[model samples]
Target: MMIKLLAIGKTDSTHLQELISEYEQRLKHYIKFELDIIPDIKNVKNLSEVQQKEKEGEAILKRLQPTDVLVLLDEHGKQHTSIEFSNYLQKKMNAGIKRMVIVIGGPYGFSEEIYQKAQGKLSLSKMTFSHQMVRLFIVEQIYRAFTILKNEPYHHQ
Candidate 1:
């Protein structure tokens, strides 16, 4: 199955971008993967946090195909160990999911509509992280999951 990571805005740090890109390249060896970025909303200074999320949510929803399974990276979502996450992905591939879209919402998080559309929510950690750093963390975890699946030496217990 194809796995895609959809995020809001660009990573301003070149160092972070380089690391994210490196993981993306590694992921290509295991499955179809893409890092799709939804442009940040304009004039956010005038909009409320909720309003910004609404606009960002609209853009995110627009990029999805009807058959894609949506998963959000939410703080309150389920947390899993590295091996468990690999199994989670294996199940999706076994079930013949055409595509899985994992979303990283804007600074304020997702809107109600976006949350409603999601099939599941996953949390990398209980502590909060910058949206930029989260991008790298998720990508690296995904790569590590694949390595674990293949019994490669990249991941440790």
Candidate 2:
């Protein structure tokens, strides 16, 4: 299965970008992985919170194919241990899932439409994180999950 991470806005911090790139390279050894950044909305300050999310949601939904399994990285979503996450990924591959699309929404979070379209939701932690930081966290966790699956020494229990 191909794993794709779609996040709103760019990672402006050079340090963070370097870290994300490191994991991106590591992920290639295990599976096809891509991180696509949806550029931030122009003149967002003028838009209402709901308006911004609606606009972002439209862009988010556009990136998805009907067959892709859409998972949102939501705070209120299910939390999984590292092993459980790896097993979840294994099951998707076992089921022949084509594209596993995980999205990290904008500041105001997802719209109703986006929520309706998602097949599942996952939470990295109960605490909130910057949208930019979440990109790095998700990528690293994905890499770690694959290493765990292969019994690699990268992940320590």
Candidate 3:
């Protein structure tokens, strides 16, 4: 199945972008992977946190297709081990899913509408990381999961 990562805003740090790209390139060997960045909202200084999330949510939802399996990277979501995540991905591929869309919400997190649309939520860790850093983490973990699935030497655990 194709795996897509949708996030709000660009990765501002050149170092982080390079790292994200490295993992993304590694992931291409295993699946059709793409990173979609939803540009940050304009004039957000006037909007409240909730309002910003609502606007971002609208943009996020617009990128989704009805058939795509939407998974949100939420702090309160289910946490999985590396091997377990690989199995979860395997199950989706086995089920013949066309695409698996994982979203990393804006700083204030997801809006209610986005929450309602999601099929599942996954947490990388209890500790919070910058939205940009989360992009790198998730991409690397995805690459690692595929390596684990294929019994490659990339993942040491």
Models ranked on TM-score = 1, 2, 3
Q: On residues 39-99, what C-alpha lDDT tens digit does candidate 1 reach at each position?
A: 8899999999999999999999899999999999999999999999999999999999999
lDDT of 1 at 74: 96
TM-score for every candidate vs. truth?
A: 0.98, 0.98, 0.97
Candidate 2 structure quality by residue, lDDT tens digits, 66-134: 999999999999999988999999999999999999999999999999999999999999998898899
For candidate 3, write residues 14-102 as lDDT tens digits: 99999999998989899999999999999999999999999999999899999999999999999999999999999999999999999
| Each model's lDDT | 0.95, 0.95, 0.95
Prediction RMSDs, each to the true structure: 0.7, 0.7, 0.8
With a 3 Å backbone cut-off (N, CA, C), the pairs that clash in candidate 2 are none
Ten-residue segment with the worst summed lDDT in candidate 1?
A: 148-157
